[model samples]
Target chain A: MSEHNDTFFIGWSNDISAGLRRFLMRAAAFVVVGLCVVSALLALSITDPARSLFGANAAPDIPLDVTLRGVLSSEPYPFLLTVGDAARPAGHGVLLSGDGKHAAVIDRAALGGQVVEVKGLLLKRGALDMLVLSESPRVLQNIQPAAPAAPVPMGRWRVVGEICDGKCGAGIMSPGTGIAHKACASLCLIGGVPPVLVLTHPLEGRQFLMIADSQGRALDRGVLRFVGMRVAMEGEVERRGDVVLIKVDTGKLRRL
Target chain B: MSSYKAVTWNRNKLIYDAVAIAAVVLYIQVYRHFGAMAGRDGIAPDDATLSMKAFGSCAFVLLSGILSIGPLARLDRRFLPLLYNRRHLGVLTCTVAAGHVASVLSWYFAYSDLPPLRALLVADTSVAQLAGFAFVILGVGAFVILLVLAATSHDFWLAFLGPRVWKAIHMAVYGAYALVFGHIAFGALQDARSPALAIMCALSAATLVVLHLLAGRKGAVEDGQFAPTAATTPWVVACDIGEIREGRGFVVKLPDGEPVAIFRHEGRLSAVSNLCAHQNGPLGEGRLVDGCITCPWHGFQYRLEDGCSPPPFTERISTYRLMLDGGRVLLDPRPNPPGTRVSAVVIPQAHQTPVNETSAP
Candidate 1:
């Protein structure tokens, strides 16, 4: 009878120990899960970029077509244009315009020998009449065009003509002022005409005369009032009619 | 055995991880200074300005790491342990962010005509100023949350608030995250020249969106729980036989579309408001780590049993009892009077070992 009791006690003890082991395992699993949760929370607190778990955002595309315009002076454009894939620093078209009365200039300081191609329509201030446009302007590039002549011949002269029509020489006229008699004498000696002035040079000066047409195109409405007034005259001669069309050489023009 | 054993076991891992991160950050900062040296001549003539930029880069890197932790955690469960130390990371990130702002202020204060205080906070100075204010706000908010979390990251708070309420207050981390993200994007990321930085920002932002989407889907699935009314009766559910798992938390849907996040711990499964009390973040979708079911949206943590604040924190949420019958989980939505303790009902199925049995032991 005592042996039977001992066997029953051992069985009961074994069952209790098994139950305890099961309980511990279950508890360990919970603890593992709990650790996971706490770790996740800590990570979120540290790295939560505040949007979503994936850090997604509403970064919709926005259009950027802004343009600015200013005088081309020695100073370059104030805004910086990110250049190249690496954003290498490069100069822009502000400083290049510094000479005289130019509309724009390209600052060559930051050019870095990298080709800069500036192209686009730049709106002018308060003028709807004419627009400034540039085709792809490649800067800092070396491209051969043609060979140059050793030394070109050039000369200068003055020719005169009357202001027969239109707004020619209009700037020379005061309210009631005419070319004063003395003024006409001096202007006639140089190359001054009522409406036109022509430049000429000895046949040796050809290059200066070639630039005369370009200079003429620049002065459509403006009159060359001081043409015969001891003005510099240097260009090849192109005699035509009684006008003595002096195609002046640009290199040797001088007041005489 | 003391409950502290489980909590303290992973402390070394936490310290080691923290040290490794610090080393990486320091290395990055040193490497960045070298990069700055290469570009020094081409940059502006101001030495001070260049130094500030280098410092800002370090701050940018730190903030990026913090923002990336969330998506990283989601991608791999191995990172689940980072949650307990996230508050410390927050402090570090905010410090770096704040330092960047300070440098900007100093640079501007000396060079620009604007007053120092105004330069720091007012948008009138420049876009940079507006962004600075946003960063500061985000930093301050994060600091507050971190201070609270760090102070209360112990068992004492768990014993006091009983887990429910404590979990609710700590959930503010989500709001702080949103603010910081915007601050970075508009402030530092906007000025970034490197494609790598842009890519990082884009990826981080995308990760956040994906996580939100997944969590939202989970919310949709449990929308039947909480009603729209503010004073609607709280939800209750009882565990069904063979439904509780020893380690897994299950979802309980209410009639109204709200869900109850139920965790089976300590031989029982208890339910709490599935919607994160802060920002309605779906807690049911969150994972369990370190005995706390962390809200996936912001990272708020609640102990496994007796929903209460862990320690040094004062927050609470509603708790419910569970029962099981015929393999169906049942919950009682009615509130239990304060101070009464009840363990969750969890039955480990693997232990049953019987093929034909229809019930859990």
Candidate 2:
């Protein structure tokens, strides 16, 4: 019975040679200390100045004073001036009045799809572009309703991407997507930042596109549920110049 | 109870805590500073957000390390020193976690149309989403648990709540750990392209699981083997009378799974429950101080005969009957009701085994 009591202590010390035990202890201590030092160094060295974890897809914000004639759409957030022969999402801008405060509100329901010339600062972030209004647009002659161009079908494809507000997703904020930024992204999208579908892979010449319904109308509250999630969307893609517009069926959006 | 209450400050503990906290702060600052320097295309530099992420990550790491210590200490006695001041580590971890929560609230939800708290709660109520409820909510849940545990870490709360209640409450750290794990898994790691973060997270989780499993297995094995044989009668041969040192105890597991501490004090043999009333610390691991059994954990004392703390202290533990037959000391399997006075058994000089003994009084 007394000998059994000694087994506890004896079992603990007898498992390993003292020299080997000392060596292993020292080695473990060294590894642990080394890991700590390395972690510290890595933490100190890894900086995300631009928050560009995805890709170098940011386009330089070229300041422009040029006035342009284009159609203004109010639905998926206000943006002006379409590039190329067709109305492709060229640059998104806010309608600012003389006082510089956002012109209380632009009656997008009435004026949407109407061609007008406006002047403002051209802010470009990646493929998404925006114009800060310098003054109210001079109602340019509304082009006689041209026969709606035949829907140029690019191709129906499945792509996985995050649904984020164009303003922040286009490098306005570092890491503008993900659960941490989900609430903020929802606010931005709700606040009328053009909701853009950033594709995980470039299909055709477009990696980013203005997300709209099947009819190319702005999807406002319908997309709130999918914001900040990587979702697989089967949508028809239409390319006009550098912009690709994805016409998605809201019911078909699948969370990846 | 010893009518003395001294300040709890220990120089070694203070130094250790200072170094740990300083290291955490330094690591976070350095990581944020460096990460900000490496600019990504298009994204504007927001130092506030960067600092938030840095501190948040550091807090997570600290929490992982803190949780790992329990299993580590169980696996190796050398790690016991780490256990003594673990409350300080937990408090510091909570402080860092609070910093993370504060930064997120200020930067992410501050400018929202709704109040910050409301916005955080209602941000994304879509339970159907793959990302789960706003990860912020998970983080908040974890933070609240940590706050509660940290606030109640002192001995006053332990005494007020009692050891069982206090231990149950503190076990909520596991709940916090689960919440934080969800917070990270769905939040930061959602759209993360870097595998480094994923690997680190997996490693931290694996280390915790493996260490706990190993320690638990070892403990189960020890508990199983501690008892030599089932007693046909009430008296079980605990050990040789000589095996116990003066003023110290030889702990033996009864057939019914209760541990009995057979103590040799003032040339007499007495038995009490090995478990201390406060915190359930092993009383057998402690020694007699001024003729009363002192608990190794919180200095809770019980008289050798009655297993009751002296006057002004109402703590009581179950006492057991002990007897000496020849060279062997036998402990009665049945425990007398707690605080019951049981007479001590004396070993005759002729039956005392010849063995070298150290006095622990």
Candidate 3:
């Protein structure tokens, strides 16, 4: 009986040894797998693209329609222009006519006071146009020289109304143009929030719409909340159909 | 005299068990790192899927290795020492499989670029990704079985469930193994280009087949050793009054070549199949505990008097009719319906022969 018991003990020991061997082999396999995975991850990190993923805030270079409100001086021969400021530097303006680049630019002092419209090619060099006057510039927008000479009292007029046409309803309010809707759509699509749009339109009363970009950026800049506020304005006015263009010099806009 | 008890414990197996578990955890960490790297490369979805495949395949390899260790030991007793950590290997395999499932789901939801709610719903749906769904289900089932087995591994559960019930429920590990194996064969091997994976699969299948064949051969060998009747043409007396030792069983055979195991406990004898139902492990070479026989291969137990398992497990084994002759034991080869109780026979210790010799000189 003792011999039998001794044999059983030996068998049990053998079984235990087998178990240990299996355990060691399994452990080794796991270590190999782990190391391989780590190496792959490191490789991926070392080879990623950097510049295009980060530097997206630079302003676009291609020309787009820009309208700013400012005071115009009636200068030599009823030239409609704004008072020169350092920020708005003077530049050589090329008049776009039937002949192309043939028109000349008048000096800023010559067109400082007269409330009139002068449309040509807008060249970016300094504050105002700084050259001798040449041919007559075609007026495509705003008040013409023969239209209205009576200054309608240079105090302050609250903006009674504003209407956004074309793609302007996208929530990107840029003073007096029409390209706000695309930006608003991008914000809505990405961030899942809408920017509040407040604008006083002449025909449709004051309206407020939550604007969102298609990518969902939303009202991150926080500049659209004062759309209905009263602001003092001093600029030569021009009306093309129902859209009024106010090229103003400066104004104190206080929220109502 | 210390009873000359032959119960030797292998301490080295415990160390090996710890090492295997640590290795599996380490592999999982590596797999996760790879997944992260893949994601950063703008290939998160592919990385996740590949990682899951790797995990499942790794688990299958480990499990097959663990299961095969027992049969390898028979080829050399020196290898028997490795068997101690087999259960740990199994548990570790299940854990790795669980991690693979989690990683796959996370990647599916994260990189599919769907809305969170939509991702969750789509993950549950079995469209366009049948492999993922099947893998998840298999992994979940294996995890549940592992949890139960791990919880009940203590001696307390052995004493609480009285061995028979515990062994029966634990047999589900094999079922889990089968499911996971199918999941990998159908899913992972599809995209594998490595000859290593193909070799591993072939080796796993061959090892399983060889191990089962050895177990069946061991059963036959035990039966042959206890011939019981050389003169009787059809009937044979399997055990003797003194041969059915306490805490142990003996495989006996009749002239018809039918095999049965006679278990002895508290001076009583009852018979069951020599083949364990769980993995076809030889029951005659196993230990008798709490009035049941425990298969030495994986510790599955069955009641001797009646084949029914304890509560919460409904598996049963074939029982044989035992008759008491003049100081000898006779067994009918044909098995009675499972769960039917048979009369017990008192077996004396004088005629019993020891199965193995002591290691101590």
Candidate 4:
């Protein structure tokens, strides 16, 4: 049998030929190296750098609590007007969402002119800020409602970018926008998370805006279906403090 | 090689499983760590998302690797070692795929009104939308098939269901593979900012298709050689007696596409079905060891005389009658009842089979 030096494999027997063992070792090494290279390439190439707050305090962490004292506004979706301290000079308008996918639970008429302290977990990124409300805000007795900056209407403008839920965009979900995040974003929007227009190219140096209908309410089904997808739309662009707001024309919203 | 129904663990199996596990770990680790480094603007994606991609990519790599082994073994005998204990590799792949499903359910499908699994099934109802249609359904289909394959991978199931039925069931791996390809093409590929998933999917499909084509070409060439004699007589001349090596088989392809393995052992020739009873492996590719034909795929041994696996192993394959008409070796096209003994045909001294050196174990 040794005359031809024929090598065959037997799975039940451990008496493998020395040559086969060496060959297998080499094969294994080659396979492992190939797999690692492919894996790294796949992981590297598909990477999206968008940040999220889900991990390490950026997201819906169970044990995170933040308090902000601000004037509650309901003109363009529910927002908290915070007085920035020394660390944050430019005062902020924070978007708010409820515990789950719902928007922050607040009576719009009662809180329109009230100064209050809002408590929630913050999802912050760039100019995007969202407070996932722990409960109803505490209306402060002593704090006076400060007159924040007036909205500067920037006329009719055409814009392009993805439509994402405000909460996820601020930091709740990393890579919180895109077709991959579409279903979740749709659920969020349907469940009352405020929708926003994340611009493809920053218009007037702003990448995001709290987007709503002409009535300043959540977008209807026609626009919400485009969530997590890039869309081009015409909206009334207005600058409010460090943040931006847009009143989108439903007829002009087209998926990009 | 085993009588009982359990994983037939051996040194080779241990080594094979260890290498498979290491490969999976290395792939996932490399993906998770390098995915961050590969990100743009010095920012990494969320941990949940990164982990999901890591497991997802690792499962793809493993499934691709697993599918490649069969054609590779067919093309080159050196790769047969990979074929040994391949079920473990299959089980590992399913486990990794399960991890991917879990990650998606926990992170993306969670915190919603619908239950995670139900949401996974019903999340994307846009079946007509090409870009982001119901790709999850394809993934679910593939996962179910993988689950079935993994569940029935035991030898007991093989024995219980019998080889033909088991093989027919396992053939659904290709269907699962098709579903997986569609799942990636429509699902992940749509949102991937880069074409990595597309490129990877293309390469995997190309490799499997090209390798199978090459192996099929080889099979066609061999099967074509002996088919012309089928119309003339039932006793087709397979080859010259000397064409078969000592202690090895020369496959004779009948016109109907069935092959019979004719082995030269102890200065005589014996014939058995070319298909192994286990996994329908190519028995003609195997060689004789200790007076029995050992299937190269999993080492299921059957005596050449009766085509019966030795006493403890209750498996059998059909045997055939061989005739030495002078120097020409002719074979009967019809297969005898499995495990029926047929006496080996002795070669005359002029064609004496090399002093019986192969008789020694």
Candidate 5:
């Protein structure tokens, strides 16, 4: 009787061990499969719309076409239009001609510091504004050669800003001005995307300013290296109708 | 399994390939549709950029799946089917990645004043920036490695390069994976505001680590339990003769964690390394086909007596000395040089004893 009892206990223990091993194997398989399923689902679930991910600030819904009399400064690549009183230090934005279909060719240097009447679409984001010119700006009046309006009191100030291509920076690409975007920004700038200086702080109702050389000329290829970097530059700050122009000395541009 | 020509198309493999392709297409289409729908309000990206993002993200997801299949199969034999035709998966991953590269080049770099390739190289040389240009270089490096692996995934290339060289080349996949991780981390993720992507990457990495650790631990434990008790002697008790059936093998792990496969055939036993010389497939999992030990992976064969592939094929695997003590089988832990001829240990009972019916332990 005692021998039978010992055999029964042994058999029972063996069965228990086999059951436990089977359970563990099943559990392991379950865990592995579960992890794979969950991971795949997670990957699928996290994919945001490309627009939201890449194009954060898109074009405005309602396009406004208006004519404004402003001062035009051509130091930067794409000319800037300072609306209202140029001496008041406010309301400046990018001056672009023609519709989105074709690139407009306007010799900005020939029309620097002249009060002009421009007709274009008014694109605004926050305090930053871009006036897409439908036609050539008609010079309403020129700064008198004698008085010169004291050169609008050009103040030499140091400011930090990222240099990015204007078209994408305005509404095309979200967070477009960064190291990751440096290469794309360079490409766009080279392809004539109007290099725009995005200021770290809002200056007189403008966060973006067109960048150019000290003599109010379009920047050369030397600025390509500083495309996506936040750099400090001592530049003469001038505003014309929601557009700010920074005449940066190429030699003084220091990467911050 | 030893056919010398192209891959034989079968129903199961055909179905698997079709399903995989369809799944990828469906995933991309669905994501694009939903993504576009979600972006109806004020943030609609242009179709070109949208398509690029769709293809790029699709390829990334496919790559993640391709990487996960290996560890998943190790954890569960049910996942083994995924491993059997993994070369197809790799090729598909390369194709998808190529699509992504195409879209990026065309949309972003094509119209640039510089040539596309030159643009990619010289556009952003900012090494000190937060999203430095190095990420693009890393991406290119990973893509190149993937391209090589995909191009050489055929059996012809496997035979030409030999298994050892082929395996070393394939191992570069891990390096590519590391580069890709850096590419995404520093590139797209730099501006990513959502936590979902970050969490998914972390989970995938953790899953791979855990699976590999568990698989390694299981092998280590098995080796530890049956390691030779006497360290001074080279001989270790492998198992009883009854543990291996005729024309089959019983795998035993040596003290150093090398698995040796002991095969029983015609009242004789021989031992060889469990790792196949080609692709490192488990020889023990394969059967004796035409008296040669066939590898389960690619049907690479070696003679049981000398651990050498037949002439015209010079691949060799290390063999061990086996001794039968009464009914118990003992294996010498020390391996004979590759291709060295070693005599088999003959059982004493010979033809008088019937083969055991019990399965291998």
Candidate 6:
């Protein structure tokens, strides 16, 4: 606490000793550069790419309106299975959502198996694709003996994965899933945006599945607590077109 | 400290503020542009998320620097300039923290079914669970602490609230810092991939701890040295007159542990409480300014003879009677009433030769 030196610093005084001034300038510069380095390091380290929806220019807010022709299914959730065109051989099984975190409202029984035209804003992350409905869809063509939007049942088994809201999982927020996005994911799931079980490891070329209850309806809200956490669930995995649907037994879900 | 009604933005204060603001801007820009790397999956983060990271990290770094200043100043006299106008840095830190909150609300909770504030409060209600507890609560708590401290940072609050009360409240900054540390450790640390954050936080925290220990040890040693020899007598021989540096206060602690600083300025010796009236800073380390013992901590000046802040500044400190008993400075352990005028003891003619005249009065 003692400095036996000639320099006396009076803060209010305008004049500063040349030696002290030099020391302060150098110190300030050093601190500033040091902070920049810290901030840069923290920013780089914390925001993970796997969690971000739009990582590496994957997608920005969809600019052009998107309309897809597909067969609608209503049992588990309102989703469209688009038929492929010349430019694209592999069609998409994109979940349909409504404005602001809610799932798209479409009469399941009426549209089931019927070919229809769906239009909405598209939100896409890796594997998960969602088309948010701008308006109610219309039947483009209803052919007799409609193509059954069949889901091939792939026998019951135990699976481990993190449950996340499909919309965010697809890429709404930069990082749309994980512990940080737990509350948001819960909100979206509550709002009826379909939940998905993102497998900890890709099982049989499948990374995720649209999650449903054992009866094959939208998932229970009680499971929201487990969202963004690693959890194990016993469920019947069904390969539905390009996507997989897991009919999980809510009773068997447990944190891992 | 002058009349604090209109904050005197001195050249140093202005320059300090400018540099701080510039640093903040530089840190944020660096974070936005260079910090984010394109992982194989997506686009740049949204403004809201980017803002959160930018402001949050910037606030953290600023807080670390702010907390480091006190101990750094003690460990080395050269670092004292950083201590000057440090409140401005604190205010800026609070401002940046608020920006983090604003960005969070705009993005994370804005789209939720629940109201933004409600979502913020009840969003992640895993308070019962240790693994996923409500870390946002810690962040909010720290923000509140920072807000209170920042709002009352002005000298007006220091005067109105009284230094003791004001200082007590400001000391809560350590608690706020702890809360912030917890907020990051639990919140970001849980989700991050790289160990950079954990490492940086550990280093910053360790640095602060080490600095405080070093400074505290130094002060303890200094305090132990000035212990009075006479327990029976009211008067204790403080030190040799030659030992008291010219234009500086030399501290002598009484038997009761109360310290009195004996100052030698212009061949005359006077004594006052070693504690500065403002913030209880170590006035003993300070030198005489315009014949007033200026507190090294904040430049608060008290007249040598009468411990009153020279007219127009009403602050005062307790003065002590000094005597030149055969060149060995004798101190009356009992203190004179604050502002009591005690005549300065003139040094013997043989010891009156001035030291350096380079420093201003």
Fnat values, candidates in order: 0.00, 0.27, 0.04, 0.58, 0.17, 0.53
- lDDT tens readout by residue for model 3, B237-336: 6755665556677777645655677777666778887766544556777666555566655455677778765554455778877766667666676778
Cα lDDT of model 4 by residue, B144-209, tens digit: 999999999988788778789998998898898888888877667767767778888999999999
Clashing pairs in 4: A53-A58, A53-A59, A53-A171, A54-A59
Q: Rank the candidates by lDDT, best first.
A: 6, 4, 2, 5, 3, 1
* TM-score list, all predictions: 0.41, 0.77, 0.41, 0.88, 0.73, 0.89
| Residue-by-residue lDDT tens digits, candidate 1, B1-361 | 1122233334433553455355435533443444333231122113333434444444444444554555544453333334435545555555555555565455433222335554334322222333222343453454455456545555455445544665665555565556556655544443344444455456656766777676456545444444222232342343344444443456666554446667655455577766554334456555565566656544555655655646643345566666554355566665443223557666456433222323322
Candidate 6's displacement at residue A236, Å, is 3.0
What does candidate 5's lDDT look like per residue over B1-361, in tens digits? 2314587666446645776676667656665565454333344444555565566666666677777776665555445446657789888878877877786677566665577788887776666655344577777888899999999998778877877899889989878778777877867665454676677667667876787788777655433245464333678888877767787667888878788898877778899988887578778755675677866444567898999988777789999998766777788899999998999988887432635545333
Error of 5 at A50 (Å): 14
Q: How many clashes (backbone N, Cα, C below 3 Å) per candidate?
A: 128, 13, 70, 4, 13, 12
Q: Model 4: residues >4 Å from true position, as ranges? A: A1-5, A43-46, A49-65, A83-92, A141-153, A214-216, A221-225, A236-243, A249-252, B1-4, B36-40, B190-199, B223-226, B229-233, B353-361
Off by over 4 Å in 6: A1-6, A43-64, A83-92, A105-115, A139-151, A249-256, B1-4, B36-43, B224-226, B229-233, B240-242, B323-330, B346-361
TM-score of chain B of each: 0.58, 0.82, 0.55, 0.92, 0.81, 0.92
lDDT of 2 at B17: 74
lDDT of 4 at A184: 75
Q: What DockQ results do all the predictions give, each relative to the true complex?
A: 0.01, 0.23, 0.03, 0.44, 0.15, 0.44
lDDT string for model 5 (A1-256, tens) is: 2112111111111222344345435644553454345434433343222222222343433447777765665544555545546332434455463443123456566666666777787655444455667788777654442222333544877877788776556554443456556677777766655777777665564566777788877777778777765678888877544446688888878877
Residue B289's lDDT in candidate 6:
71
Which window of ten consecutive residues has the lowest lDDT sum in model 3 chain A? A171-180
